[model samples]
Target: MKTEAEIKVAIETYGDMIRRICFLHLKQYADVEDIFQNVFFKYATKREAFDSAEHEKAWLIRVTINACHDFLGSWFKKKAVLTEDFSQFQIDPHSDQGHLLDIVMTLSPKYRDIIYLYYYEGYKIVEIAALLKKNENTIHTRLRRAKQELKEKLGGDYFD
Candidate 1:
């Protein structure tokens, strides 16, 4: 059995990174808490036989990203409306980030995931390619396409 110390170490090291990944996927306050709980639960189950720390961290991140995808698939939510309110935002009041996020949600999954991992998670394009298990060229192309798509949907005048 893995000791509690090992589990504690993983949480301390990668908790926020995992949380950001989960938020990117689930994108709902309630769903986030549920997913967060699920991540730790799964970790405990798997920790019965411990791997190296590097292996464990990578596994945790991979599972968090997959969990988000699974959550989205199971929910079957429709495309986001452009009219959602942004009053809950507390940063860059003049910056219209929420509207941009709404526009991003309307994007194709390929684009949205690339953008989330690259921008929100601060993963380099190369790092993102490794994590998502896609070719470097493919990640580059998708990121370019995702940005172009977002700009078109939001228009140059949005939130300005």
Candidate 2:
């Protein structure tokens, strides 16, 4: 177990990163906050002793991703579709970042999630695989498909 001070430092240091992970996964403000809380809740409950800062950060990210997966599963079962695949968006530059997020949202959710982690969150394929609990090859293939999908949605300028 870490000292209280050490744990506090971890929370302070990693909290924003966890929040960003949730935001990238869910995109909705409320859902992102819920997943953010779930990340800390899992930390409080798991009771596993971390070997290092890197371990703690990875564990937090893993839990955040799992929580988002759970959220998506329950969400689809319970609710009507909240928005269309694309075009319902207001083109808010911060959220959509011009047309990129719009194009990303058009992707099937599987590819969208991987692309969000890879491009928006700056996670490498190996790191994204670990965070999303997917095989590296799966991540690679999804990334390729995601780019192709975006290109189709955004026209040839997607690469330019």
- Candidate 2's residue-wise lDDT over 1-160, tens digit each? 4456765776799888777666555767667777877777667666668888677777887787778878878946368565535434335755547567556666776786687677765779998888777899999998987888788786675754
Question: Clashing residue pairs, candidate 1?
Answer: none
Query: Please, what are the lDDT tens digits per residue for candidate 1 over residues 10-110?
Result: 78887877776665566665666678878877887773554576557667777887887787777344554435554463234356675566677677767
For all predicted structures, in order, the TM-scores are 0.67, 0.71
Q: Candidate 2: give the clashing pairs.
A: none
Cα error, residue 40 of model 2, in Å, equals: 0.8
- Going through the candidates in the order shown, the clash numbers are 0, 0
- Predicted structure with the largest TM-score when compared to the true one: 2
* Candidate 2 RMSD to the real structure: 4.7
